[model samples]
Target: MDLKNLHVLQQLMDLSQDCFLVPGPVRMGQPCLNALSTPVMTARGPEFRDVMAHLNSGLRNAFNLAPSEPVRGVQSWSGDDDYKVVVVSGSGTAAMEMVIANRFRSNDLVLVPTNGKFGERVAEMCQRFCNVKHLKYEWGRAFDLYELERQLERGCYESLLICHNETSTGITQDAAAIAEMCARHNTSFILDGITSVGGMPVHPTEWKAEAVVVGAQKCTAGPSGIAAIAINSNFIERVHAIRDQGDSNPNYYLDLVAALKKGGDDQTPWTPAINLAMGWGAALDVLKNESNKVRWDRCETMANGVRNLFLDLGFELLADAEQRSSTVTSILYPEGIDDAWRARLKEEFNTQVIGAQDHLKGKMFRIGSMGETPISEMVEGCKRMIECFTQFGMELPKVDVESYFK
Candidate 1:
């Protein structure tokens, strides 16, 4: 209701501001957007094949397919020779559903640890295809590895599913340890790292996962409509086995075997989002310019800055300090703040953050710092949040957000 604050907020919204702080479908940058605007390529043609080859390789390298390669200069876009990536014409949910539908059968016992919403979704998706055992934990909390190992010791499961970054709660599981347990149990592992893979240093292949599914949005800095799944030789063998026995999943579009068949020639079984794929290649290129560690550090720096801003403003974070995601921060509103703050933020400053769902509603909001979001954008986001707070006539404690970030 402050006129002066409203004027400043309007200026903030118009100040060359274009960045996403709500996780997926982040800014694609000018170059990638330009690529998207260009003519669409034939999904299976020579020109498209060449570029897709590069995208595949860049994607594998970005996902840490192998040990850190020599700090090679930017030369070409060829992917890792040892890895194979499938580009699905759907969101991360599709890729995840594919992994579940293809890897386990109705009789196979599958274990899922659900501490957050994404993990729960994975569990729900698997219920139709496999016999699921829920290792449930409270939302906004980390999973218990001891219990996970005990579940593995039961040796009843043939597949294990986990979300590396549970976006809803901003919790990142210790995938390394989970992988070790899955390996020991001789279980097929599927890691849904939709929000974690590019924003953190994760070695999914080396982690012994059968598949690691990530999306073009979220940490990849591309638009939605495409998801990438990296499959290991072990998983590919299962696909071959299923195909040989004439056993097919009920869902044809989400069939991993069909995807793998086309991926052999760097193509997809169905028509892909060609322009989005092209843009995804550029996004992969941007991350491949430096070490994955460097990119992860960049995301973490912005995430920590956002976290510090929330903490300094007396807001409690949802996840534990050690297990919080580097890509998004789930923040509990400070005292005297309510859910209406979300509408106020958007209306006053064109600023947006995700509010929690179901039970967590009105308890917290999520701010993303992954993809193309750098420190400057996070600083700007913090400024806008402060302005939104002041516009609501709430007195905040003396906290110099920028100086704190500095």
Candidate 2:
């Protein structure tokens, strides 16, 4: 319980190095970086605890729920009574697993439309739990909604899975359009918004999404660990009806009904990541402020800044500007440079940038402006990157950092 011992602190500090940039050349201009320096307490803060206490009282007063709701910080349904939200361990993957395990029996037909790495992971996860009918697409190409509709009309699936933002390739699907089509077809819809939520406009309730899964790290500006799902009442009822027929729930940890019945109070079936949750709570408080719109617009503005920087530097983006994700920007590495040179840039520059997944690995590198990353850091990161390119024997344009950052 004493998490402050020197050895423990050292380990935590080491982990923080990997999780955050501290007074380094890459620090983001956000208060979150400061929060990381403090000792993480196990319990909630006084203000957060008071809010939970009031929510607990409200739940009890309205729903007649037991004290269990307080433990998990579950609040009463104030907006729409037709849906339930559940928090879980892993990131968005956990929420997605919960929906896949609970909604369908083993070998039940489902449509999985994959465009990138996360989309492929969704299909893989679905296959692990059910018989998935994968509708695969090229990594950077847009999915054909008409083809999706045609496949659905062929009567082969009971559910459809879509990833709103394919982080691997900077492609965002038309989720609202897909949700509308699924609604018309009476097919269950599950959307993976791991990198889309909070950074972009996503209203799960209004979009008629059966299940919307989100992670804390990407758009929420939170530490990784906590993942959440918003489930409509109809989906909950469907799970109940399936269980009533004596089918086994494929996954116990991801069982939404059992989690909700705990009144949102108990610890997860598995031990929870407490410190990460604390960080997430702090991040969410920042997100709920009225200036959240400005924060999102800042992401858009920063993304545009990055895109324009790359284009001005004579490097092409991997995806179209309109379809690219506001959170991460993928750029095709300039021609004539091989993978070995790309690896050298990171070794020399002391900057971390992600390369493409699978076949696109040698062709592209991705830079993210997610969380509290400052636009200045990105502008400088690009300059260092260009310097590295020049050092690697690649011909590069002369970038005036003074004018660039201005």
Candidate 3:
């Protein structure tokens, strides 16, 4: 074998290597329809110059804060003035890691309530960086607050981490109740509000969250590169004391204290995604201008429409009707149907729906109504889904999908 072109080149030429870049099924924002695509129009010439001159001012104005504020105005308020917010390269994962590495000591026990994929990820994140004690819940199932409080009273944990909206299973936990429980136990509360910040109701300050994290991709209607974590003054002081004592923070890029000191005008610890920041600025402006109640009601109405359609189609929902997330819904697949039926639905109808993850995969599929989806479009998607089910030999009752729009 000519080693230069034999072993190495053979491996490089393998067919399996090419599979990585192959396009998967179309996603929510990147629907097949060109008209519905998320507009990423960049500023040009004078518009670009004007945006550049006043971008910082725009960000400050959006949050009703000063330009020199230590915290990034994009983050939700976490009930403290001293704490600083920092933007990171990764999404919610970056926010989680930053908080975990900065806040926890070697032996500090943290409580994680796992109800879905994101909640499980929170546990995994904690396990890697801190001593974790999981307070597990079944997927699609909401935890009882009384039981959670009792567990926290008995457990030796410094912080309790939860995913406010478990997008994986379409269940939204009560962050305020969870935070109150943590408060009673004198434990710090960390909430992953990645999917709930804008579309869903989440007031970190009122919820008693000591630290909160959100990503731009979900409810913010922004690009994915930017993430923010808001911390309480007490939490910041604790992290600052740890840093001052020469304790090594594991990740360099997500060091919030350092990022805050540098100010948002300067580059991030790494090169910032300038384009994403621009999109995020625009999206945040839209969110601020739009009434919160109106946006929330729209999501609620869409979710309910989907749920009603599922009922008419003779399918069971994974979560209780009241507890289901307004942003997404996970409905059980028809009994005795094979995966091929799902494939046919996608290929023939030009509609994209998500199958469940892990144990729930093949058992259920998730339908989401978020991020600029018109009510009429959602109704059409549901009607198509029903038709697909009928084509697969599962007879579905006709639904007044049009009435759902009203």
Model 1 clash pairs?
Answer: 57-79
The digit string of per-residue lDDT tens for model 2 on 1-406 reads 1335434634532322222211111232244445445564434344434333333332222211122333334443222345555566787788788888888878588899988889999999888877988889888688888999898887778889988888888877888888888888888888888777666666676677777777767776766666667677788888888888867456677776676665344334454455554555556556555244665676677677777777888888877556877777788977776566556545444456777888988898877766566666666566666766775576766766545434
Worst ten in a row by lDDT for model 1? 69-78
Candidate number of the best lDDT: 1
Q: What is the C-alpha local distance difference test score of each model?
A: 0.78, 0.66, 0.66
**How would you encode candidate 3's per-residue C-alpha lDDT over 184-266 as one tens digit per residue?**
88888988877776667776656567777777667656676667776667788888887888764576878877765644333
Ranking of all predicted structures according to TM-score, beginning with the best and ending with the worst: 1, 3, 2
After TM-score superposition, the amount by which residue 237's alpha carbon in candidate 3 deviates from its true location, in angstroms, is 1.5
Worst 10 residues of 3 by lDDT: 17-26
1-406: candidate 1 lDDT, tens digit per residue: 5888667756656645643578877777776788788786677786776666666766776677752222222222224434567778899999888877887656778899988888999989888887889888999788888998898999888888998899989989988888888888898788898998788978865787788899988888877888888877778787778767766457788877777766656667888778887888778778887567888998888888888877877778999888988898899877667779888776666677889977888988889878877777778778878777776676778777667555
Which runs in model 2 stand beyond 4 Å of their true positions? 1-78, 264-270, 338-347, 398-406
Candidate order by decreasing lDDT: 1, 3, 2
All candidates' TM-scores? 0.92, 0.79, 0.80
